[model samples]
Target: MSETLSGQATSTISAVVGRADVLIVGGGLSGAMLAAQLLRLPGRRRILIVEPRAELGRGEAYSATELGHTLNGNAARMSVDPDNADDLTQWLEAFIAKGGWPESDQQHVPVSELFPPRGIFGLYVQQRLAEAREQGAVSGSTAEHVCGEAVDLHIDSSGARLTLADGQCLEGAYAVLATGMFPAARTRQKHSSGLNAAAIDPWDVAAMSRLDPQGTVLIIGSGLTMVDAVVSLEQAGHRGPIRVFSRHGLLPHVRRQPPAWEDFLAADQSIRSPRQLLREVRRQCAAALASGIDWQAPLDTVRAHIGRLWSQASDVQRRQFVRHVRPWWESHHHRSPPLSAELVERLYKEGRLTIEAASLKGLDEPRDGRVSISIRPRGESRARTVTGEALINSTGIEYDWRRVDRPLPQQLLARGLIRPGPLALGIAADPGGAVVDAEGDVSTRLFAMGPPLRGMWWESTAVTDVASQAKALAVRLAQLMDSQKGRG
Candidate 1:
């Protein structure tokens, strides 16, 4: 049968089904990792992860069904456990030994160095979560996966109540908003004629497949998502030309193995401003290059200190960095896998792909079948028109909560339960992942992690960043639960 909590059922959809010590609002990697960490700790608390997806680990980024979509980082650095950095590498070795991958795929790349498919990584995450769930069962702590979207949240003196889209309610001692990256909002075209029918989601493979194989494709914002779109086209046997446009026309640098450089900032730890930090980084890069090392070595060293640097920077400095340095930093820091870069290079050399630095003016109505795009090339005032069978917006993830069209975020903003973080990057959160309300009060019943904590940690989206945050948040939440139990 079904479990029930001590709350009244207001609708026929369902009653308040159950209660948990910790209620997680997302089931992506961040939520899964947090749940896993909590399960490992000494406790018998119940954890309920509410997610709309059928599986827990495959969030938007890793949920791609395409074989060409692969992880940007290697297995050694992608482990869920921050303490055991090589856990994924070890797991991958055993997986290969047990014939986890097909022989044909295994022979093509070295397992340790391979950028495995996103789908495979998703499976690995699901497997880890499943194992953690089993461990929780053995420890008398229970973790339940609730398949539903959290539409609204209400907090009271005792705890917080979550309302699902289907009208079911769940009450928990504590709630975590682990909602990860939101899709980039559609650009409001100046001339909103028939352009609506021309734009399609970049990741929608079915929609891409429906396009004429020979028709030109116009992709907006040439970054990682643009690469994914190109790969998807190639996988679908698309042979037509592709034109990609963005403000900077910057493509991600190819990922390369770099030796560890000395941590110059580790001892000093005084650099707070982005300008000061960038100056030091440039100096180190030059020194590394002089010493026959890739410049990436010095930049890689900065990864460990990004959170501290971001936290210490003044709001004005932070805004300056976003306005001036974000584009270059993104292109250099978030690199493309070598294989994908090579594919893009090959296509460019063959004249099948064109990348341009330009600003999108507006989209004209679809004439016959193709859509017309008006763009002003960088440094040129004259506008030119280009026609494509379809347009895909690869502008990347939207971080500002205020602009997100999701129901949960909208409701949260309406209730003043959360506020915008620094520079309106994401949801307001403290260093420890606790949500801060509009009145600048720390939330006792509500917390957050993952991408929503980006304002607190500039590099929070990566697995390493998320894993460390998850571990720390899990420990903190466990302590809170213990105190609540003691009071009871």
Candidate 2:
């Protein structure tokens, strides 16, 4: 009895109806996009997409209530079209034509500009997905969307069966897992003291809504999440000081204006280990700066070929980079909106914002209802305590599911269907994103995409990267299903 958002259970009629040609387990951006691509194919096929969320397109990344939450990339670079480079721009134009935005805000902005409102992109994705669903209806193939969590997967020589949480079962020739980012649980470290309430996980809307207007908020990490926290606080009328603490104490750089375009790093040159790739990025960043342009030009170059770059890396090199270099790489590669960064810098200069290089040591709850945090600086042995009216974790989403310490993963691990990646970095998978089983062999039908496969591919988080992977995976599935049908 799998259930939809309405809590209406779906009976075990799928098997009787015949298995879906493809069953997608997570209906976030990747899963939704993949479904759209499959429906666009020129053949009749039954597809079922299983997602627990009531909302479809937003998922974890794009779902945001605040207007301040914008996309990390600009509209031009965020297009869904693999063919038309200006797809997002065209999409925006069409949206504006439909009277979707204010005329004053309709200035021509380059796609390379880092747009900060993720809700806008979420709306775009929803519109596109809805259109695709209509297209699917017109075609011979039919798509059924199930609102339920896929709790278990059983696979044999014939096909794969998915067991939903409510006990409804769905059998499909193929399935793809697109579980997005899951944030790490707050630690009991000293630095987190007085910060428990301040810790605002990205997914917690209730927590964010409880923020006090005049409270001094301490953010745990400095990244895109921190950027989001800052913007959200401002929107929430937080006038007090906001502090961001992290190991590197480095915030993401802002996108430069008049977007610099350099095709220096060819797509083929992207194939290399993480170390080699980091060196290439460094060289390119330096070259861009030397040539009197901002460092973002090189990053844009890298994003164009990130999938190939990750696919080519050896597993050992991939692990090494995740451990030693991921934090720094993330700050530079996933940047913030220029205006937002400027606001943060202004807050810093005005003494309303402070970024500290330290690890959280403790969190103390005050009787008066405030939290106190203890932090030990990177080098000094001495610890310091800072009291904030509020503490927002803003540490960003954690990909390492092992840290989630959830029952489902534990159960799956025992069943030998899935394994944690190197150091529990992310869900383990092969280059093509087929989940590695407990016995260390790649499962044939169980596939995963998006941030869940971060361990397998170091650069798998962003929408552009994930969309490309989803499209490629759709092609593979189409080919695989076609071959199977031919055999039958």
Candidate 3:
């Protein structure tokens, strides 16, 4: 169910079929992690997870049916346990021994370096949640899966009341806005560019298969998503030219298992501004290359300090970073898996994939069973029309809450319950994921995590980051509940 927030207290509990101590608005990895953390705590708080999907833990990111769609991070770096870094590696090793993933041997890499399929990752998440559920059951802390969409939310001094699409209401002492990222291709838009209506989904290999096998494909945006589309095309037997367009036509750097370099950022305490950070990074890269080390080693070490650095930087510095460094930052930081990168490179070398430094102007009406789009090449004065047999909008995830054409985000903004994050990246929230309203007041009963905390924690979407946040947030919630118990 989808819900928009209302400021006034129409908080009626009538017809409420469900009541929980914690109401988790999303059942994706973030919600599942929160539930697991809450269950682990020494308390008996009831948790109700509201999600429309039939299965939990598999959000938009992991709901891939294609094995070609693999997680960007390898197992070692993607562990959900903060203290136990090799948790996923240990689980995967046992699972592979039991003939779970027969294709595991093809990677030929150590279990820690093998990037699992997104679907399999979702399965791993579900298994962890199940284990947590059993522990919770023994502790008398219950977790229920409410299979429905939330449409309306009302908050009062006592608690929050949520209304679902089926007219059923659910109440809870606290609510979490754990809704995940909204991919541009799948999400509806308030003001659209007609790209989504004409473009095919990035993961839909079946739809790509129906297209002319030898016809050209037009792809907008060149990032990890673009890499996925290229892989999808090859898997669907597409042999025609693939034209990729973006403002800055930079492909993601291939992820590598590079030897560890010294943690330069940790050793330096003066790196606060984006400029200083970039300069230091360049120096570290030069030093690493001079020492015959991969540049990625130094950059990878900076991942741990990103939230601290980004949050501490002034707004001017942030804008400067966005204007001057965002393109390079994204391309360098969000790297592609080796196999997918190899395919993209092979197709490009084979004269089948052409990348253009251009910006999409708009869409032209389809003519002769082909998709037409207007694009102005970089540094060009005029826009030209290009047509292809198929078009895929691989732009990436939509981060701005105000621009998200969803019922909940729209209502949240309308009601001033949440404000846009710095530079409108995502919704604004305090350090602990307490939502900040338009009037600059932090929310106590309402909190958020995961991708919704993009602005609060720049790298909050990563598996490790989400796990740490869940642990901290769960501890905070337990403290709040304990205080309430003391008062009662």
Provide the clash count, candidate 1.
0
lDDT (Cα, tens digit) per residue for candidate 3, span 1-488: 22222212224433333568999998999999999899988988888888888888888887887788888889998888888999999989998999988998998999999998889888888888889988988879877777767777777788888877766688999999889998898888756677798889988898999988889999999999999999889899899999999999999999998888888788987988888989999999999999899999999999999999889887888888888888998999999988899999999899999999999999999999889999999999999999999999989888998888887788778878889998888889899988898899988888999998887667888788889999999999899989998999
The model with the greatest TM-score is: 3
Q: Rank the candidates by lDDT, best first.
A: 3, 1, 2
lDDT per residue for candidate 2 within 1-488, as digits (tens), equals: 22132244356455444588888877788887888778777767878888878877778777776656777777766777666657667777677667665531643554334363676777777777777777777777766668877788888877789887877788898878877776542433323233443566544445655777667887888887788777767766677888788977888877655356666668446447767777777887788788887777777776666555565666777677766777777777777776677878788899999898988787755637776778888898998888777777766656656555444455577688888875576788887788898789888788888888876666677777777787788788888888898998
Off by over 4 Å in 2: 1-6, 9-18, 103-116, 185-198, 201-211, 257-280, 305-316, 365-367
TM for every model, in the order presented, reads 0.93, 0.88, 0.96
Top-down TM-score ranking: 3, 1, 2
Clashes within 3 Å, all models in order = 0, 30, 7
Instruction: Kindly report which residue stretches of model 3 are placed more than 4 angstroms away from their true locations once superposed.
Output: 1-17
Ten contiguous residues with the weakest lDDT in model 3: 1-10
C-alpha lDDT of residue 169 in model 2: 85
Better of 1 and 3 by lDDT: 3
Residue 329 alpha-carbon offset, candidate 2, angstroms: 1.6
